[model samples]
Target: MSVSARDALRMAALYVVLSMLWLVVAGRVLDHLFDGSVAMAVGSHLSSLIWVLASAVLIFITRARLLSFIGLGTRRRKQDSERLRMAEAVFDTTLEGVLVTDRTGLIVHVNRAFMRITGYQQDEVLGQRPSKFKSGHHGPEFYRQIYTSLAQTGEWSGEIWNRRKRGEIYPQWQTIRAIRDDQGEVSHYVAVFSDISAIKHSEQELAYLAHHDPLTGLPNRLLFNDRVEQALGTAQSHKRGCALLLMDLDHFQSINDGLGHTLGDQLLKRVAERLSHWLGAGVTLARLGGDEFGVLLERCPHVGEAASLARDVIEHMKEPFSFEGHRLFISVSIGISLFPSDALTGEQLLRNADSALFKAKANGRADYALYTEELTAHAQHRVETAGELRRALEQNELRVYFQPVHDLTSGVMVGVESLVRWEHPERGLVPPGDFIPIAERTGLIGEIDLWVLRQACSQMMRWQAQGRSLAFVAVNISSRLFSQRGLYLEVAQVLAETGMNPALLEVEVTESAVMDDPEVSLEQLHRLRELGLRLAIDDFGTGYSSLLRLKRLPVQKLKIDQGFVAGLPDDDDDIAIVRVIIALARSMGMQVHAEGIEQAEQADFLLQQGCQLGQGYRFGRPMPADALKWG
Candidate 1:
């Protein structure tokens, strides 16, 4: 079959011809038949032997060349048998589960890993369809899409859930390739897959940690914001509406301050549970941050419905909870913002909800309010006010006005309460009621409070140098500023700089401030008292004015709220409350001062009630320091 074999045959024929010719010629010479001459006979035999030996040598050379050509040009049957053995070895030894299927998705071949991974023997899967391993985790459309891609691209790689022989479903990372024949028709599909259950589980855990709050086990701000964005997009496309409710727990700081943060954390977890149960499945409740949460109603029917839901949340938040041997009572203020009406984006929705929350808190907490155009205006106004307040502190736009507190028995001045008033350049005089709470929220109160304290002390010293011996001068302390670290030191430094006696410097704090964080407030109060300064509870009976907490406070004076006394004599409850407070203060060795005494009857009633001090419009409106006549 080879050219070299043909050449060898031709060479063999040529050698045979040459050998025959020689033999014929030698035979002619040896024609001298076996004559009586023994030498002639021996010569003929030697020539014939030599001719046969040469012919054998030619045949050996031609055969060797023919065999060498055959070995190079053609494969032997035994080599094919060895190749089949090696391929079987590799197919059986591979670690991955290999499945060979016809183009119709039927199983035609499977390796040992396929048997191990699916817990099935080779015989069981050999003739079965690939769908036998389908866990039904994907729908028909999913498979259609996969097959379509494989048909178009000749390959596919993805994750899928498959069933094992043990009737358990597991995830697998799979790669499938289309096997083609010489005519380019798909002959089979080879799919290589491996179990990925552990990988899937790890991925789920990581996702949970990333999107859920660790302490409360609720969706955190990250996931909540994502849901809100999705809801907004859906609402926009569907021509529907959604509502975002922002809620914050009131009096939550008191829990953390009275009980440690551990107890507070437990309480928050319980609160999250309550909200999740009550908010329903359609609403997503998420813990945004400390004491604050958010809810997204994906398809709210109307703003009124959202309002009603917010109301329910507020009402439920009032329910008392007992955790870790502590009874906790908290309330929530909810702010609602509607999609496509109030905002279009997640950020705008959150901001609008926050603005409504501010309005809810300002109007009185523990209630729900809808976002309105006015609320946005008010929010912008608050921002402007905050900026102005900051500049006011830096530019000295705040001034202190002193209101004289008198001894009702002697009809003489005892001390003056220093109040800070903001003098706005454009708006003229801005009342404390308008800007004080704003300052507190904007975090600008701390600076303004310190400035007021310094100014009050300096004025008191000036009065003392003028030969006016006063009992004391009180400066109202803003609770926002009182919570800062080194507050007592700041007060002490101010007193030291002004050369004012510590005993003559009193700090008046509202009852709510003391109740905000009783533990921290008590510690600060003790520190101030230890500095030789006096403490008083201003606007008494207006907030969490508990007799138990009052007993523990280092307070020397109880200033009755003007609200109660403003409508006294006509309001029996007011009269009875005032009598009771005066009796309680007198018994505790604390002086009582009745505020807002405008009518003679009010002053007369206070005098008879054994109240020792009074201050109101009847005596004198709050005046400038220079207008005060101490003597």
Candidate 2:
């Protein structure tokens, strides 16, 4: 029995004994004091009264003590019931699943959350062991480690995978604690756990996004570099060779510019898929960035293997891709670099491969090239030229060369096509072909175009001041500059600054440039035309120009590409194409200007075809502004 119950029993026994003693002593005193019947009766009554009074007094005292004990016991029982109610409330309402298990690991009690999380009823798991829910992902050693930690520290918490009642495995964060009795001996284990599958899935997705390109679903630059390092390391260990191929799609920018970014993104995805399909085992293809892809070939036996793979990739790319009802043809230029032969390290290998890729692009598209030491010299020269070009404007090394355009009927110089020439201090004069593409690729072409415009306008103003009559000064605008948002404003500013008539300053844009985002081009061209400036399409036949769309363009002249003009009257195909272009331009109320008129017969053929204006070396080679003699 408990100490409080024992004390109560002892006190009750003492009270009973004391009452008996009082009754006995009172009876004895009454018998001794009375002898006669009447006296005895009175004494008996008195004794009886005394006995009754003493019994009532004893009952009052014991009742008071018993009442106090009962009240104390009732309060204690109420407090114990309240505590049990609060504990049960917490056990049922908590979010974390709770399980109470005996020392033998047998589940005895579980909360509502436990049933919700594990899909198991309280009756179902009451006598079952926790192993019944095991996903088998954790081996014997894992449980051994858990038990060891629990035994030593009396508590353990970690992430664990477990199976639900439906056999679906999921991860959970769990904490198990040993519950000890007052004697400090463990009696049961209390476990609390929460499902963390969603968190785990989110983490996995984040990891995937970090290493992959969102658009192409291919390995990004960071992952590609890591793979290259691993491939190189493996090749080194086995004394084998590996190859790194860097590829760039030819004319991808034209497609991107012509069609929209949406189509461009779709094209990239298709390219990635085709490249991935062409690659076999041990080859890793990754979209390094933009239109460029990186391929790593591990344990490549020979340089021929890399070359063969490159050819296969190129051949596969030749097939037309159909997207959104549009048939598109694309090609790839590839560059290969071998391990140990090119350079050590991933960066160096990529650099060398890129150098070879540059060489391939320079030679022409739809080709592949292996890294050569000589290509490094060319790349270094390009780098030097790029730096020199940046300083060309500041150093006054840039000059405007005007080529005379003649009126075919009168054989008179009517206008000048303004061209830019970079007079490098060391190189004397760098041709436009040599540096123009470099400038375009490096994004310096826009600034060069702007400088050319300012210089051309200034020269025209100077010519007008000298009493020279000229119809117009045509200045070539790069695609980059043509697509700029504030191009019209910049042109207006230039015209105002140079004090030249906008009508005399004709801005020349290539057909491809105007065709890219025609809506935007149309808006910009309309804005330029609003300023009373003449717009002309340069190299007209070289691009994909829709005549239906061309009818809406605010252009006044079409210049035949020099390629067709070079052959002129001899090439039948050239003659037909030139005639059709002239008819097309004339029908649209646009003037036709034939470029590259090097011979009298070419001029005569163009004149016979009814083309009015022509320009080439036959009339006058491109000369500096001051050297020009007006006729």
Candidate 3:
């Protein structure tokens, strides 16, 4: 019961006692003073009634005031209870862990989330300091900084590594705030935090993926370039030499085509692993793309060190790799460029290394080449020439020249091979060797091949109109064009437009081209054969051709590469190779043609060896159709 109710009851009891005494005394006095008087008795009765009415009114007013005070007190208690429930709900249900501490930093209270996140019970950490959950990842200075900030600003928030109850370390985002009393004095501290381990892990994964190759788990081009820039800076500062090596796997495309991409990817991973194993400290190896890898050698002592490393890389790569029971042999060509010697900037270093790699590939596979100033000049020239070649095609500055092939037995011009010559207005005449490679590299070879095919066909028809009876007109096709999907359609269209017989048109592809992807090459060759055009393998002996695969090819002829022919009968190896090729062609019932016959002895030797066809400078150099001399 309320104090007000108790006081009201006491006052009422006092009034009741007084009223009883007064009633008794007044009744006696009235009886004694007005004895035997009827009027006096009546006056006494009226005075007693008036006193009773006043006492009843005073009691009613006090009771009403006490009831109003009691009701107001009850409503205030109900409101306080509701507010307590709301505070409890918020404290327990919030996702963020809440911990309250006294001014001395001892934990006083913790919410359900705090218990769940730290794996600690409320009883276990009730009076413990926040240091009890320290992961030791942050030093004393780190905590001092936080405390200093908190002291100055009354609050602090940041990422912190904390230890859970199970002794595992995790990251959390935490905010600590100081609670002050009404007098502006600090009395308590509250901390709210959330586990951010998962977010940190995701960020790390994203960062790693950005800089690494997904297939090989090797650093990618972006990372490689950044590392190169750093390495260059270090080299420049320390006055030390550094080397950049760019590597390309030789015949990797053939392996990819033959064995399938999955196996190819596995091969690349193995290759990366081997290269990484061979690298010493301070060396970084990365995959630039598709069978291409980059190596940065920091603090290299000299060029000889770079060369030695390159040689070691080549030798290691030469070792055969066995994957899924298939023994595969791989080789890499390396191009080395030095910092502050060959080039300075990261971009130039990479470019020069790539240029050297191209030279290494051209010299022959399985070798290494150092970047030279000459290579840069050549590369720049090729870039300029590629642009000119593109314009040449658009402006009709290209001309078709014919080189006649003679039947060795009859000594008669049988067929003519069509070759393109660029009549550069300023350079006079640019050889095909000068610009054809550039065209191929720039992806302009297909367009050039198409143009050559159409012009060659048109020229053959013009020669026929002039009463020249040529056996056939052969045109060289780029490897890219041979694999193109629309090659058949393009050839068909050219033939229809030129009104030439497909039987008299022969398309020549290198042995490397057909063997690159024999299945696809077979399919494409079959499509071409279906058009009634003859197909031949050019530079036959220069590539690795399996006789079994060669037998399966849809070709009618194999032209001996000029290299083997140049060293004729006196060169025993050349003689043996040529004899074997001719014998192989005869056994397969395919025609054999010998190229690069510069002397009468070479021709006589070829004829004696049973080679039926020959073409070289001896018969005639490539010339315009109007300048051709028929013999």
Candidate 4:
């Protein structure tokens, strides 16, 4: 019981005891002092009336105190006033919305925060249940679970979907507790919650970025690998075949180099859209870094079906993709590896597919290749060869062989194109065709290229001392080296060390290399040109060159690729291509050099086509520097 009620009870007990004592003592005194019976009765009645008046005054004071405790009357304590104000401040100032409902589950009170969050006024929500804010996203069972938890444990706190006054559904982290009376019976329910929409959205975004490519907004390698693993499991259970098609965009590096990276990123997004559109059900298409994409087909029953799918993709990509007024034509080389037959695991499947993709690119891109045991053997061989070549390069076991470049009309040796050959201690001399690609793939070509340049410069210095009549000693710079900014410095250092005239050195950069990053290549070429050296675009007809960019190149010679000269005067296509290249060279005021001349007819045909220089078996095969006896 409250202190006010106890005080009231004590006051009433004291009044009863005093009133009984007064009645006994006053009756005796009145009877003893009065002579007549009428006088004694009158005294007793008068005394009773006085005691009633005292009781009335005491009852009035106690009733007023009790009313104050129940908040019906004015408060009499300083602490009570401050405590009431403090509780009101807390309820109004808290960030989380606070709501109170009566024992009947009707909303009785809501704080200012509740009004701000739900957009409902106090008068509007009063006497209404929380169902007014139901988002309808949760079914009956969901609410039942919430009520069950609250009833058993007196509280339920979790994420829930709630509707605003505007009818928009949003998420909130809410805690609903059953507030009970002193008798342990629930008298009210209080709910406290905060908006978690922003938090939930951030979580979703983090999850998406973790497994998706930022550029393409498609599944990245991580997600792609996971889907492939899932597909393999499904295929195994059903005893069906699954195909993993690894597609690589052909010559994509050139685009990225020529165009800015921003444009490249935009193109990647566009490519993702196209891939997403073309893919059907049972397949997951993903961006697997750079210009590579992986397609996981869970139901590719046979190799033929996979090949058909690959062909369709190739054909689809053949169409030009127009972006921001640039019509770009691109092709995809797809490499397919079958499940169970080729491999059982995702890693093996991907490896086999990648090996096949290498072949597709090597055999000429815009095609498809199926994984074969032979391809795997070739890959193993390449790995072994790359290791040996690295060793050969480091151990000084590699030799520079010079091939003669002649004046086509005069049939005179004017220059020699320097080539690298690996003289393995055990394997004898390994031709460039066998190890060049390997070196390029392993990133050892740049080092080999620099070494060859230094060697060639040194050999030419010897020839200069011996009074050789050669106009220049040309060094074929690998694509890997040509793109580097340090090429000019390396060449200058070699020239300075060897004391060879810069005019006697011709650096031959391939047409493809020059076009890769034309702006950078232009600056590179100009730097070399400023050093008084000749620059030539080697294998001209093979690489697609922009005429506008080519005209800006500081080149004196254009070497027609051997592939265009193998058939020479016989093959119409070769003849036509050679004639056009020679004309193109002439038009650009560049010297035309024909390579791979074996017979007199090939040399004669090149000479007839007005080609200025020719290098091939016709003049002399590639030989060591010692073989050229100029002295």
TM-score for candidate 3, residues paired by index: 0.75
Clashing pairs in 1: none
Query: What lDDT score is found at residue 56 in candidate 2?
Result: 86
lDDT tens string, model 3, 1-631? 9975897688878988988888888787777777677856786787689777978787688778868877898889999989999998999999999999999999999999999999999999999999999999999999999999989999999999999999999999999999999999999999999999899999999999999999889899999999999989988999998999999999787776666789999999999988888785668999999999999988787899999989999998889998799888889999999988999999999999988998998898799999999999987887899889989999999999999899999989999999999999999899888988788768899998999899999988988898889989999999878767579999999999999999999999999899887887888899999999999999989989988888998889989999999999799999999999999998999999999999989999999988999999999999998898886
Whole-model lDDT values for every prediction: 0.87, 0.91, 0.91, 0.89
- Which tens-of-lDDT digit does each residue in 81-142 have in candidate 1? 78999988888898889999887777889999899999999888887899888898899998
- For each of the candidates, the C-alpha root-mean-square deviation to the true structure, in angstroms, is 8.5, 5.7, 6.5, 8.4
Ordered by TM-score, highest first, the candidates read 2, 3, 4, 1
Q: lDDT of candidate 3 vs native?
A: 0.91
- TM-score: model 1 vs. ground truth: 0.68
Q: Which ten residues in a row have the lowest lDDT in candidate 2?
A: 251-260
Which residue segments of model 1 deviate by more than 4 Å? Answer: 1-210, 482-486, 516-521, 569-571
lDDT of 2: 0.91
| TM-score of each predicted structure versus truth | 0.68, 0.78, 0.75, 0.72
Clashing pairs in 4: none
Off by over 4 Å in 4: 1-93, 100-109, 124-170, 174-191, 384-399, 404-414, 423-428, 441-451, 454-471, 480-502, 514-524, 543-552, 564-588, 597-614, 617-628
